[model samples]
Target: MTSDDAAQPCPMPNAHRRLMDCHAQWHRLHEVYFDPHEFRLTMNSLVQNLRNVTWLLQKQKAQLVGFDEWYLRFQQSSGSNEIMRWIVKSRNRITKEADLELLSELQVVWHQDWLQRTIGTSSKYPPRMSIREITNDVMRRYRPPFGTMTVRRRWVDKALPAWELLDATSEAYTRLEELLAEGHSAAAVPMCDLEAHDRECVTSSLRASGTRPHCMVDAKDDLEAHFDLVEGVEIESTSLVIERDEELIAKSVERYGSRAEIPTSGPIDAVPGFMANARQLMETDGEHGTFVFLYRGDALIKMGGLLFYNQNSKILAFEKLASQVKAMNADGVLVIAESWFARPTKKEEELGTVFFPARDRLDRMEALTVYAATRDGKTAGQISLVTRDASGRAICAEPDDMDDAVVNTLAPILRIWAEMDSSTN
Candidate 1:
């Protein structure tokens, strides 16, 4: 060898880097599971990153003896594994064809005891009530037990396993990690446990244990049916309405204070200012109301109102309103409304005995949702149930779709506003 060649350092293979990159993409997939647009982007990225592991390994085959033989065996094993095969096919489809098809199922289950309590034990009622009747009866109640309502959302594809999308992805990740480890071993390279890295990175509390064989990634709890209660509620059958007027808006601004100065620290710092404004609007409105506020920095530009007969209409209305708001070149748009929210059964502290999981009772309630977006396409928001008593005193429900830190910052303020007399304000 030439003296110059002897002095030069040998280049290291980047297969390990590619493997870690693939793992990072997997974690991103978990974060964007609910957002279809973001999910697609992350899913495609994960596939590409995973596929790059082998490509990188092959690229550095000259440095690793017996790489060709080891890779051939790995390919055979991957072909036999269903998830691995799907991963390969997904990468090919994403590269050459269209995006992979995804199917989603939203299941809402009500416990048996909860239904009994809601309907009452009166024999005067029929064995079954029409969807409209049930909706009307539930809405008639001054305070519905919304916290007892359980909602489970799952995404799947015909090409994928029966498991939820996250679970399936976790299984795929496990196989890939094994392949990477074995490849490294065959190449005589030192490697840390990828599973350990995954545990440290994606520490979602929703993650279930022993759901998948040799799976280190987080997996959502499986949707299970209780023998004591009915299986699922048709989300389509539910109808809800939200109405707002100038009078309510005026009252809200007067009562909740026209301007709220949000702190520039903690989780609130990460959220857009307009979202806090929207939330303040909800807190002031206090009841079933929908509001649209356009803002430029801390200043309110224009305010509008919205009316929705159902959830679907509400969503469409927001979309149209967002488009209109964007066309007006506003700095930010805040949409705040109180509507029925259904999700997986969880304890609601405010409701007390109304949401008794030990007795297998569940309830549904109205939720105040605040959403904000900027002209630059940034968005942030929060969801919570703020109920009031006969005396107009606010009772803040457990926080939803937001961390405790954000809720704790806002809840005390809501209570304070609720105590103040509107006439004085």
Candidate 2:
């Protein structure tokens, strides 16, 4: 028995030992296993080293596992269960109940994590590590205030999740050098006083330009970055108020008496084609508002700005806007001076009007909530322009609520036109 046991190498303690011997002697295969904590720690170490390359690594991970396949797995296991809820709640460091409640509401039941804050341990993950989910959570939290936020594809792998670890002594020394030199050069640029967005944009543009370093005025040495906020933005109103001539208004109303009024909608290609992008030429070529009368019917043809000034883009599109005014010459301005047509627009004609009765008119009722962007009168509201069918029952030309600006601006013009025209009818 002693001899047999000696030959058997004192018998392995467990299946693992036997497997290890078999792996070495018989199969010559290495039985590999990853230490969960150690592997995670190792990956976390790469965060500082590969800050720029983070996205690429995450993409590779996704590609190896197959995006669709791993996505399903991720969905199954991540940010779920009571433990996860506790983890999230425990992670958030915010102490105030209001702030905590806000965070809870923002994160949702599954993604809410408070473990890191509570445990006094939190690590920022790499690009692919835990970023996408967190980013998606943030996007979901913030409701779109303006049409500008069209947040669909904006977050598409834009920022890699990697924390840059700065060595205090070395970074401070390097920053001191950066602080001493003009920041225009990448070698010396200081990141201070510049907003985050502007700094990033300027840095990116400067890098892309590949221009040799030139003297920069008022360049700072140290880089300090923060998010940008608009300061004293000038918003010049695009609209204006114009005085109406009672005589001219009457004639316009008479010409528009509702005798089986016809719609203006037409085939998409009703007009003969010109240059495809003539909009610019018509908009900016002239001094101001442009108008034309159709000789065939002795009526106004399509009227556009004589000279359209694009304040935002700073591009002028004359001849594009159908301008005929100054410079080469002409000035960019409004010729008709904010005139709303007495009649409905060609689009309104196509959409057909719905009539509301006299009793339904809020003007007829007391304590009506007549909302206005800017009110003029004591009780500011619209005064409708009236027309009639064969029945002669009053039919005020109704404006749509969908276009508050257009309705508010055009209401007075229509009413003035109607009063002047009522005399002739």
Candidate 3:
């Protein structure tokens, strides 16, 4: 028995042993075939071996504890299941003159999903390794054996999956390095922030330098060496705020709207292709007095900013919004200012309105919560409450025992925006 076979103890040793042997014969079939006829022969043999293994498992179904989980090993994988199914269907129909166009399709799907190079513990095998030992070995060697003429074809096929893995792995390390350098604890850095920084740094670097490192081994080495630097750092949380009071909006309009070209400012609004993406941004309502407009733009594309619903009169309110949208049109997005619904403290008056840092915006989408109704020229608590996202999608709404007309006005607008589904709201 191999080291792996010895490690996993199976109750039915005879059945398990047969499965392992079947897996070995199937894997050896991956050897390169010099002739198309030889390739078809290998594929036929593999299909028959798979059929025998499947039949054996069905026969011993009661003996296995992880039959469902073990089967998932094949189903969860990208194209392995499809390849198996295709081969099974071609079994009786396959001839020595068989055209193996399906092999080309398999190459494309496998490369796209990076199913070839096994990495990480999670990617290694199923939890009950004994149950999957046979199938895993067979799948690893499913392809035809590489010959001198086929070597170049194999290299071209594997290049893309390798490059994609290298790029993603490198960017993850780069983000960790940036977060640690900024004196932020790894635990405190939200997942959204890590993803954002990874995309930004990789994109900027790629633009400046046409080439990137393709060595994952070196990348893994560097990550291990610096892992200690970020192990137990102190956590800190801070934010910069841009107040949405009257004076600031007037200045923003004059500054951004005056120029014929739009001014791109703030991380959210300065993303590439903002104009094209803005057309997709959705408007939504939120809890308390909060209103929002979520940019439906690509995650890589940035276009986020704040507008305020401070105007008391309905006519003036919409006019102010229209003006703000025109001024911020360069970024192509204008979310309602988060602070508009937040009660101001004495410290805020001194900060004024300009660019300021804040906690990751996406992370705090559901932070604000307040409920009030207008009565006797004063604001009072109301039982009914609602919350919505920038896309005008209602996140939550709780009806009171008795609904008041004044408070119910805060309900979400269900209008269908252009190019968006009418049922979305």
TM-score of each: 0.37, 0.14, 0.22
**Could you give candidate 2's per-residue lDDT for residues 260-370 as a string of tens digits?**
221232111111111111222222231113221111122122233223233221111211121111100111111222122234445546787524323344443211111
RMSD of 1: 19.7
* Model 1 alpha-carbon drift over 4 Å, by segment: 1-13, 107-151, 192-199, 202-425
When sorted by TM-score, best at the front, the candidate numbers are 1, 3, 2
Candidate achieving the largest lDDT: 1
lDDT of 1 by residue, 40-155 (tens): 78877777777777777778878776767867877887777666777788889889998888765544333222112122222222223332443334334422343223234555
1 versus 2: better lDDT goes to = 1
lDDT of 1 at 154: 55
The candidate that achieves the highest TM-score relative to the unseen native structure: 1
lDDT of each: 0.49, 0.23, 0.28
Selected candidate, larger TM-score, 1 vs 3: 1
